[model samples]
Every structure is written in C-alpha cells, then in structure tokens.
Target: MNIGIIGGGAIGLLCASYLSQHHDITVLTRRKEQAEEIRTSGLKRTVKGETFRASVKARAGITGVFDLLIVTVKYHHLQEVLDGLSTLPRQRILFLQNGMAHLLDLENWDTSHSIYIGVVEHGAMKVSDHAVNHTGIGVIKWGAFHPEDTAAVRNALNETPAQFQMIYTDEWKKVLEEKLLVNVCINPLTALLHVKNGELIANPAYEYMMKCAFEEALSILGLAEKERLWSHVVSICKKTAANQSSMLQDIVKGRETERKAIVGYLLKKAQAQEITAPHLTFFNRSLEVLEKKQTKSFE
Candidate 1:
C-alpha cells in the first residue's frame, strides 16, 4: 500500500512511521529542515517499552497518486489542504482531526471525495526534530464519519499499525455528536487555562466553563434538549481526565490554536439552528483573547 501522509505534524509523522514498516510511507511537509532530518535519521518514536527508528520518505510536495492519503492537518487548514489535494483523483481521504464544525463543509468539498471521518484518540507529540512521544493508548474510529469508505479502506486500516475499530452503521451522526461533545468540553478550556486533561478535574473554574461549552454543543447536536446535552458532556469529561489535549499543546507552543475549529464550529452550528449558546460564545471569546495575547508575545 502506498500511503501518503499530509501535514508532517505528530499524527502525520507517527502514522507514516508506523505504516512504513508494513507499507511504503511518504511524508509531505512544507519545511525543508524536517525533510532533511527525516531523510537522514528516519522517524524516531518513544513509547512504553522501546524506542526505535523507521525510514519514511519525506517530501516537500506532492507529485503522484497514493493509495491512501491521510488528511492529518489541523481542522483550520482543511480548505487549503483539500485544494492542494484536488488533483489526486479518487483516494481515501481520512480526516483525523478534532471537532464537529468542519463536518458541515465536508459534503461540499468534493461530493465524491470518499470521506472517512476518523476520530483518533491517540496522544502523540513531537519530542524533537524527527522524534515523537506516543503518550497514551487510543484507537481510530473509522467508517462512522463518512459512509463512502469501501472495503479497501478496511483492508488498508487492518494493514496499519493502529487498530481500526469500525462502527459499521449508517447512523454516524450519533458518533460525530459524541466526538463534538468531547472537543467542546476539553480542547478550549485546556488551551485557555494552560492545563492538562487532568487539571480540568482539579479546577472547578474550567469544569464550569467546560460544562457551558458542552451544553451549547449538545444542543447543537440536535439531541432535542439542552439539559440532555449537558449530561452527556459531564459524563465524558470525567472519563478522559489525565491526558494533555492537542489544542492545549498548541497553546503552550505559542502557535495558532484550533479554537476556531472546535468552539467556532459549534457556535456556527448553533447559529444555523437559531439558538444562542452564551457559554460557547464565552469560551470562543476567551480563546480569542488568549490567542491575541499569544500572537502579540510572538510579534
């Protein structure tokens, strides 16, 4: 299987590294330095028992067809990424990003773009130039986001290092709603407060804010009532209370956070429903302030 990974960040690099052992892996990046680093030293991974390296071809651009094109970029860059990939005929485009906001636009992107809405719960981070730390255990949820995925996707997924837990059903709306609940509750507050997943447990301040974001998002999920939505949010937060979310990690790096993708997406959905969620708006606003502060510091 020729697997081409877009976005040389944690997910892109890690997926390419693991899949390379079983398949031909190609990593696409904009940075020449990362390309040189990967070509010289291969991809380095640090996990529980062992740390090893694998040779994955790193490239600065795309020029050929690939069997699997993993769309691993952050949600905010989906448009630009899709535009670049427009020439790559028919391929399996698995979206491993977070949040529900971007889903609305997916149907419009290329009606034939076999979309697989993948929610990766894996905790991975770049420890160095070509090294990544796999911090936690999580599986990839496949066939839930888009039903267009064929048997080939299943075959390719089974071939990869990551286990694919297939939700074989036409009712993927429920799955996306569950994912949206997690993103709204965890991503924003964690980034805003500079806290890890466990911190949301210690601080009632974040918990309260998370509760608000959840209520707003749940309502948007079209689950019927606002209170029912809030209940789902509360239960899930307590479940994954230890890991550091990707959005929070982005904030710590002083880089652009995925607030627009997470919170901003929810707000847009709520607006379409003609509903006002003050809490979602509040978190979105709070993130704006924090983003502005971080941007100024960088400037």
Candidate 2:
C-alpha cells in the first residue's frame, strides 16, 4: 500500500520509518526546510539505541492519491491538514491524534474517506528534523468511525511490522474514552506540575491531586462506574514511569501543548452536560496561561 503520512512529528516519523519497509511512504512535513532535510538525509529512527535512516519521499505540500493517508498531526492542526487535502480522494484516511476532540471534526467531514482513529500507546520523541527515538513499544488500537472502514483497517493492520502490533476493534468510543481519560488526567497534571510520569504516582500530594482530577472528569463523563478507568491511568504512569508526558515535553521545549483539544474539549462537554468540573476547569485555565506565555516568548 502507498501511504502518505502528514505532520512529520514524532509519531509520524516513527510510523513512516517502520511502515516504509513494506509500503511506499510519503511524509509531509510542516516546513520546506524539514522536508528538504529529510529528502537529503532521509528519515532517521532510533530504537533501543540503534539508529537507521529510511529512504522515503518527503514533501512540504499535499499532492496525488494514496492508498492510505495517516494524519499524525496534533489536534489543533487537524483542520489545516484536512483543508490541504480537500482536493484529493479520501478513501482511507487514518487519524492518529491525542484526544477525542477531533471526532467532531471527523463527523463534519464531507468526504468519502473511510475514516479511522488510532490510539497510540507507544512513546516516541522527535530528536531532530529527520530523526525520532522510539522510547517504549506499545500496541496501537484501530477503530473505524464507519462500518465500511473495517476492511481497510484490517488490511492496514495485517501489514504491521513485527516490532509494532495493531488490533482492530469496533469499540471506538470506549477506546477513545479510555485514551481521553488518561490524557485529561495525566497530561495536564504533568504539564502543570513540571514533573515526570512517575512523580504523579510516587508523590503523595501529586497522587492525591491526580485522583481528584480524574474522579471529577470520570464523574462528568459518567465513567465513574467503570473501575478500569482509574487503574488504566495508574498503569500508564507505571509503564512509562521514567518518561515525561507529551504535554510536559512540549511545555519544557517551549512548544505549544494540546491542552485545548484534551482539557478544553472536556470543559465543553461538562458545560453541555451540566456537570461542574472545577478541577478540570482550573487546569484548563492554567494550561492556557502557559500556552499564552509560550506564544509570547516565541513572538
């Protein structure tokens, strides 16, 4: 299958590096400079201290038809990607964003793409313009927004490399809900506290706050009855104990975080459901303040 991966970020580059071995891949970078660098040096990836470059087509603009279009951009940039692909065929579009916020955008898409959403548990970091480090290996859950997308999703999974495993499921909402629970609880707290993933569970005060924030979010989303949700959050912290949450990495790097898509989306849902989520609301505001500061500094 021919694949066009958008964003060229950590997840994008990681996926391109692995998938390029079996499929023809084209990576779309946000800047001409990065694209040019990839074209000249190829896309590099490091796993377990071993590194190699994969030769793949790299470009700055979206063009031509593809068997699959994997969108690995942040949630805030989803619309820009969609707009750029407006003229192309949307047969098999895969979105690998962080939060459930992009579901609304997908719902409103007036295209013929067999839309699929992937919840990535793998931990990866972009080391440079053309390189990425795969920190932790995890399974990717594939969920289709529509029934017609199952076959495409299965084929994509069938082509998965040995190092990565893909599971196809019909419970997309539950999958996303689980992922959102973790992101809303862990990502913001780590970003705000400027702590590592383990600190959230290891420190008593931070653990208290983590539970408080998570319970409030679960209650608002009516997932309080699901016992597994809390355990899932703790498990993620334990599994990726030494690593920084993506939001914390972004904040530390002075880059924009995905606060709006995760916490901001929950706030809207809480308002619509008439649930008061003070903890989430507080963190959401705090994250916005940090984002604004980062933007001002960049300016």
Candidate 3:
C-alpha cells in the first residue's frame, strides 16, 4: 500500500515509521524545513532506548493519489487538513484524531469518500519534527463510519505487523464511545492537575473525581456495563503511568488543548440527553480559563 501520512507530529511520525516497514510511505508535513530534514536525514524513531531510521518520502502538500491517507493531526488543526484537500478525491482517508467530535464535522463534508475512524491506544511523544518516542505499544482499534469503507480497510490490514495490530468491528460507535469515556474523564483532570497518567490512580481525591466523570459519561452514553470499562481505564493509567496525557502535553508545550472536542462534545450531548454532568462541566470550565491564561502569558 502507498500510504500518505498527514501531520508531522508524534503519532504521524510513529505511524509512518512502523507502517513504512511494509508499505510504501510518504509523510505530508506542513513545514518545508521538516520535509527537507526528513528527505535529507530520513525519519529518526526511538523505541524504548534504541534509535533507528525509516526510509520514507516527505512532502509539504498532498501530491498524487495514494492507497491510504492517514490523518494524524490534532482535532483543532483538522479544518486546515480538510481545506488543503478540498479539491482531492476522498477515497481512503483514515482519521486518527482523539475525540468523537470530529465525526459530526465529517458529516457536513460534501464528499462521497469512504471515511474510517481510528481510536489509537499507543503512547507516543514528539522528540522532534523528525523523531518520535514510542513510549508504550498498544492496539489500534479502527472501524468505518460508513459501510462502504469496510472492504478497503480489511484489505489494508491483511498482512499488518503483529506489533502494529489493527482490529476491525461493525460496532464502531461503541468503540468510539468507549474511547470518548476515557478522554472526557482522564484528559481534563490530568491536564488541569499537571500530573502524569498514574497520578490520578495514585491520588485518592483525583481517583474519586475520575470515577465521577467516568460514571457520568457512561450513563450519558447509555453504556450499561460500567465496571468493566472502569477497570479498562485503570489498566490504561497503569500501563502508561509515566506518560503524559495528550492534553497535558499540549498545555505544557503552550499549544491549544482539545477540550472543546473532547469534553465540550460530551457537554453538548449531556444537554441533549437532559443529563447533568456537573463534575465534567466544572472541569471543562476550569480548563478553558486556564488555557486562556496560559495563551495570554505566552503571547
């Protein structure tokens, strides 16, 4: 498969490095310097402590048609990607964003392309534009929002590497909802408290708040099995104990977080369902205020 990965962030570089082993990969970055650097130096990837390079092509914009175009950009920057490819045919664009909110935006797109949504479980951090740290290896669960997209996805996953495992399911809504549960619960609290993944579990007060957020979101989404998913969330925290949540990274790096897409999406749903999400509501507001203050200080 000829894969074109958009964005030059950690997830984008990590996916390109691993998938490039089997597929012909080209990375689409937004900057000329990054593209040139990759072209000159190849992509440097650090897994555990070992550093290696992946031979891949890098471009500043979309060029020719590809077998698969993997979008690994942040939720806030998604519109830039959509606008960049406004003239292209959307046959096999795989979005690997963090939140469920982008689905609503995708519905408004005036294209008949097959769209696939993926919930990434792996832990990755950007060491540089051309380097990524693969902190924790986890499964990538993906499914198509439309029925027309399924066959192509299966073909792409036919000989996928064991370490880069991909699971396909018909119940994509359930899959995304489960991920959204974790995002809404874990992201804001970690970002606000400026703590690592395990701190929420290690600290009693934070753990209680996480539980409240989880129960409220699960109830709102109408998922009957709460205990199982709660355990799953704890397992994730333990698994990625040393890793920083994506939101916290954004805050620390002075970039905008995806509170609107993650927590904001849930709040909108809660309103529609006439369900009160006070804990989520408070955290969302607090994060927004903090983000504003941070942005101002940086400016």
What is the per-residue lDDT of model 3 for residues 209-263, given as tens digits with 9 covering 90 to 100? 9999998888788897778999989988887788899899988998899998899
Worst lDDT run of 10 residues, candidate 1, spans: 162-171
List TM-score per model, in order: 0.87, 0.95, 0.94
Q: Model 1: C-alpha RMSD to truth?
A: 3.1
| Model 1 backbone overlap count | 0
lDDT of 3 at 297: 64
Expressed as tens digits, the lDDT of each residue in 54-157 for candidate 1 is 99888776546778778788888888787877876776677777776667768678655567776776678888768887766566665645545377767766
CA lDDT, candidate 2, residue 253: 93
Q: What's the lDDT for all of these models?
A: 0.74, 0.86, 0.86
Q: Rank the candidates by TM-score, best first.
A: 2, 3, 1
Off by over 4 Å in 2: 294-299
- Number of clashing residue pairs in every model? 0, 1, 0
Question: What is the TM-score of candidate 1?
Answer: 0.87
| Model 3 TM | 0.94
Q: For model 2, how does the per-residue alpha-carbon lDDT over 73-106 read when each residue is reduced to its tens digit?
A: 9998889889887778656778898888899888
How high is the lDDT of residue 248 in model 3? 94
Model 1 spans with C-alpha error above 4 angstroms: 144-149, 162-172, 224-240, 294-299
